[model samples]
Target chain A: MDLEDLYRILRTGHVQAQGIVDTVPDPMLVLDSALTVQSANRAFFRTFAVDRYDTIGQHLYDLGNGQWDIPELRRLLGEVIPKSSAVIDYKVEHDFPHIGKKIMLLTARTVFNPDNVSHLMLLSIVDITDRSRKEAEFEAVFGELRHRLKNVLGLVRALANQTKAEGVSGEEYRTAFLGRLQAVADANDLALSDHGDDSLDALVARATKPFQTAPETIIVEPSPPLTLASKEIMSLSLLLHELATNAVKYGALSAPAGTVRIRWEVEQGDHPLLRLSWRESGGPPVRKPASTGYGTQLIQFAIAYNLGGNVEQNYRTEGFEAEIVVPLERAARPD
Target chain B: MQKTILIVEDEFIIAMDLKVILERLGWRVLGPVPKVANALRLLEDELPTLALLDVNLGDQLVTPVAEALRSRGVPFAVASAYDKPELIGGAVLAGVPNAGKPTSEWSLLEVLAKLSPP
Candidate 1:
């Protein structure tokens, strides 16, 4: 072919190559043997927020005020690329200006002409920052789940060891221990359910469901929309379970005419407080025990220790009543 | 000596049970405080012969309490369900005695033996 015809064909081929590289989704750059940028695709400019004027003909290390001058990247290009025809999936983590910290996967391929002389290197960058961040978050959540499971098992063991066996038969002891365990499991299921809905009403309903002989036996008054953290939900579940268990054996739920009314409201003060009341009526006469039992201490500790709340119980001949007042910030999950 | 010991555990049942066990084991028990603030407050006025600390206390870690006890020269051991060091991350807890949870009586005695001198 004549020189003019050959020149036109080479120019057309170069433009077609440029078009194909620009279409690639990942940012790409063509570098000379000296590692200076000869060309960069549209994605390279868009992803790094740089223009062709500053990017073209600039040393790869000098681009964007030396943000790309990463030690790992340097080693990949300087040492690894020289020995191999292509370096694939060279992971580089760096803090880039205006882009924040980024985890990137780079692929560098040596380009050779017909004479088999390598004159250029093709570098493509895939930003895996978001993917890595999501992975880290997933790992944190999994660790938390594992930690919580261990704690639950530990708590169950503690419960078994502490369960009173003085006068109660084996069956009675088993029933008591299993009832408490059921309460804990129910609260956990509600807390960790896919929807993650831990509303006060839902917790009360779940904790009291097993004790409810009929739906009407237990009455829950309409309360404000309040969601609690997982710990708070667990504590509240135990508190409710103890109250219902007592009522079932000795209080309101034991009598057909008996009923328990549960209500809660937020009291606004210097610091907001959640006031929850459990009142029972229509059962046998109620009297305070001479000595506190496991149920009593569990109820007290579940409120005072776990929730940083206050519990006031009054054993009146008419019925048994308890009012719990917890700091609103601890009771309601902060938005 | 009175052989007094401090218990810094958050879980109510565990704390109460530990208190009973320690008492039965013939050691005088101080507050079974659940929060870091409570533990720090108790440390202000009283120093026990030894302490048992739970790694996670509701929302707070036991790092501050560990630091306080360390600075006070009071020996303590960690009680955690998590066995991994990274999971129970804290520079203060490195090489500290760990009494893993669901702790048996023998394990408790072993941890106590490590913290106290004969």
Candidate 2:
């Protein structure tokens, strides 16, 4: 078709030339250099809940219930006027009775018609609230994974140092060393696992998995469930493992007739307290080890250094006694 | 008189190394011992010119030993890989020189110099 024929058909068959922009699905607005609302599409009118016909020839800031920032938009318009294209996340809300929320990502460009004169600034806004919300959620999840992975790595380092001096060159020593190493790994794995509800008993049960077998006597006193912090959980797990190993080797658990008693109780009035005790009796007479070993060091390190808790071990003539004292609410501030 | 020096070290190999080094330095190494109790018992008998102590004797923190050395007026030096200055007790940091574990002959002599009767 010829140019004249195409122009006549578009003008006569379609609605008026000025009314075509009003029917678009995407919310769009046209502005002039004076920051005036030259025209607005029907979608724009529906989005801001304003009459587009009445909004035309009004100031851009006057539309949208005067929520569109006048000075701030002047700055953005300056940029788009020079660059001919700019996009940004924009927030526009009405000052009069809060008409409607216009939180959108908008792109604007300066347009010049065949007249060769810059007459309009065309702006298209897109709702991207869902995308930004998802991005935030993903970031938080990623951060949590990184932190947990680092905690696991730190546990591995502690295990490596704990087992390094055992002199495990031969097969027998190698087997014992590997078993202890796996125990540490297992504790770390449990720490990473989820506890649907906060329960201290369940956590301690998982931590004592390695030493809960026969030939070894382990007892847990009945107590109400308590909440514990992740750091406290990890540190306490390794500390208990070290103690249980020592009990198996030198303390009461080492002997057939010997027994290990684990007891804990929480006290609350003003400041809460979590007190635990490990007593071993009916074993051979206990004597202080001439040399402290890794097991003992690990228990001390975890209690004193990592968890900031108190520990006292007495090698009595009858048996070994260990007590640990800590606050009940481990996740308090400034701790 | 062979002046004695108590070695408060946890690892047997490292204790033996200290004994060898102290003896080679011409000082009598008494009880390259691992525990604090043994060192305390021996301290009642003779006054050592000095002591080479490992800050961490496995589970036994050497704070008590540092205090004992201070009470006896015997000079001592601390040696540990993981010693933090902030966590160190007052006696541990007061006038006592610190040398890391697995020390060289030169640094051992440096520690010995602090024990000299000045």
Candidate 3:
């Protein structure tokens, strides 16, 4: 080949190689045997926020005011790589002065000449800061799910044992226990599902769906959209279940013309509050119970104890009414 | 002295069930409080003969309440579904008798037996 043709071919090949290196998504550096920066890719420059003027020919350890002078990096390049010739996925966790913190996986390989003389090391950095963070978040979510499952089973057991079986038939006891168990399971399903719908409306609809005999039997008034935390979902579901069960049996859903209205709104303030009202009408005339039952206590406990909220129940002669007030922040607490 | 027991469980039904069981066992139940703050306040007013702690209370851990019980020299056991003691965390709760939840009357009796030595 003519010298002019050879020069053009070599120039084209150099440009192609540079283009390939620049296209790499991960930060990369070509370091000499003495660990001086021989070259860097576009990603490297962009990642470290440095320019070729300050980076090229500079010692790797001295780059960016010695930010690259990590003890682990020094060990890998100075000692480990010489013996191994290449190190793959060596972890280096460091807090950079400019960039807060980074967890990096470095894959480095020695570039050998035709005579097998290794002069340059190709170091590629895969920033795992975001990936590792997501992994950790997954672990936390998994742990929380396991915890919730255990607690649910525990609560179920407690329900089975605590369901008042005294002076009641075996069949009656079974029905009562099963009803509470169903409430717990339904609540847990709503809490743990990844449907991206944790709205209070969703919880109410799910919890009260089984008790509805007809479309207009129970009316849910159009309420502002409000989301609830898993904990709040569990507590509110149980409360709603208890209230609906009572209504179905005697208060609102028993008679043909019976109806129940459910509505809620957020009260804006220094500490926001969620006020939900359940008013029952058009059923058998209501009378205050002579003694409070387990269901009554459970309804109270679900709000007052579980959510640190207050519940006001009025057994009006016409129908039953309940006002539930929960602190917005408390209701939205992360599980 | 009344055989009073403090119950530290967040779940309303579970706490109520524990109270019923403890009452039936002839132990006067103290506050079956759901929060750490409530339990601590109850402890300030009175120290029960024993305490039963649940590992997680909503968003808070029961470690502070467990520590409070320990420093008061009141013996306690964990009533939780978590089989692993390490996951429960806290030096005070480790190796402490655990009555695994879904706790039967027998399991509770076992924990209660260990909690108090007549």
Candidate 4:
């Protein structure tokens, strides 16, 4: 070939190679044996936030104020590539002053010239910061889920032991334990439901639905919509279950003519408060129990401690009445 | 004097069950104290022969009480639902006896028998 033709062909090949390098999406660098940057791709300058003037001909460790001087990088380039001719997925994690924290995976290979002597190293960098962050977040979530499951299982075991300790018949224990477990399950379902936050009315309805024998026997008065926090739903469900169990056994729902009225009202002030009442009538004459039972203690504890509320029950001859006053900040959604 | 075993558990039902089991075993059960502060307070007033600790008390870890018992040369066992290696770490907790939760009566008694004073 003529000299002019050869020169044009060589120039075109060089431009084509440069174009391919510049067009590559991943950050890339070509460095000589001395670790001085001979050339870099467009992505390299953009990804590292350095101008071409600041990068070309600069030492790899000196650029970007030594941000690229990672020990892992040094090891891969200094030792690994020399022995293996290439290295892949050499990970480096660092907190750069310009980019905060980043995780990068590097693949490097040595390139040789026509003389069969190694001329330069081609290094490709993949920014895997987001992927690594998502992986870490998934691990944390999985760990938290495991922790919660363990705690729930522990609580269930405690419940089973306490139920057995009541000295009731096997059938009675099964019935009571199943009911308590259902209450817990219901609360969990409500918490994980699509709404995330459930209304107080809906919670009461769900808790008392299984106990209702006939319609209108339990009258729920319409009240202002008050959303309950996810944490409060479980305790409130258990409290309602206890109250309903009492009504069914001895208070109001025991008789055909008995009626139970549940009503609530919100009082707004410097600190809002929700006052809920459970009044029973038309059943057998109510008398104060000789001593509080475990159910009573659980209900009172749930109200007083879990909801940060006060519970007062008065045993009158007509019926049983219980009132609960809860701080809105603890149970209610903010306006 | 009967050897006393201090119980630190947050769950009331679990505490009651542990109290019953320990008492039935002929040991005087001390505080089944629910809170770390209350347990620490009990420690100030009385020194039990041994202690049974639950690793998690609501939001607080039982590390402080564990550390206190270790410094005082008091023998103790941890009863928790969490995996021992994952939840319990550090040089202080190395080799401390652990009873996994939903703990069988036999395992609990075995650990207690080991800790009981001769």
TM-score of chain A of each: 0.79, 0.68, 0.72, 0.83
Query: Between the candidate structures 2 and 4, which one is better when assessed by TM-score?
Result: 4
* Tens-digit per-residue lDDT, A190-280, candidate 4: 8778874477877888898998888978889988888887656777887888888889888989999999999999898888888989999
- Compute the interface RMSD for each candidate structure: 1.2, 10.9, 1.4, 3.0
Candidate 3, residues A1-335: lDDT per residue as tens digits?
A: 99999999999998997899999999999888888998899999888788998998999989999999999998998889989978999999999998779999999999887776657889999999999999999988897778767777778878888788899999989988888888888777877779856788788888888877889988999988887887788788888988988898779788889999999988877787889999999999998989988898988888888677899999998999999999877556222
Model 4: colliding residue pairs? none
TM-score per candidate: 0.84, 0.55, 0.78, 0.82
Q: Please, what are the lDDT tens digits per residue for candidate 2 over residues A1-335? A: 99999999987754564577766676888888676887778788776677757788988777655666655565667654576455555543223345433346667777676676656678776655556678889977885565345434433433443364554576755655566566556555554567532345655676566676663477787765666765566556666777777877888877788878778777775667777888889778899999987667666656555344677888887989888876655352221
Could you tell me which 10 consecutive residues in candidate 3 chain A have the lowest summed lDDT? A326-335
Candidate ranking under lDDT, highest first, comes to 1, 3, 4, 2
Residue A89 lDDT (model 2): 54
Clashing pairs in 1: none
Could you list the CA RMSD of all candidates, in the order they appear?
3.6, 12.1, 4.7, 3.7
TM-score of chain B of 1: 0.94
Q: lDDT at A332 for candidate 3?
A: 67
Q: Score chain A of model 2 by TM-score against the reference chain A.
A: 0.68
Alpha-carbon error at A324 in model 4, in Å?
4.1
Model 1: per-residue Cα lDDT over B51-70, one tens digit each: 99898887788888889998
What is the interface root-mean-square deviation of candidate 3? 1.4
* Model 4, span B1-114: residue lDDT tens: 788988987655567667767788888988877777887898999889999888877667788888888889889988876565324434565566777676657778878777
List DockQ, one per candidate, in order: 0.75, 0.04, 0.74, 0.38
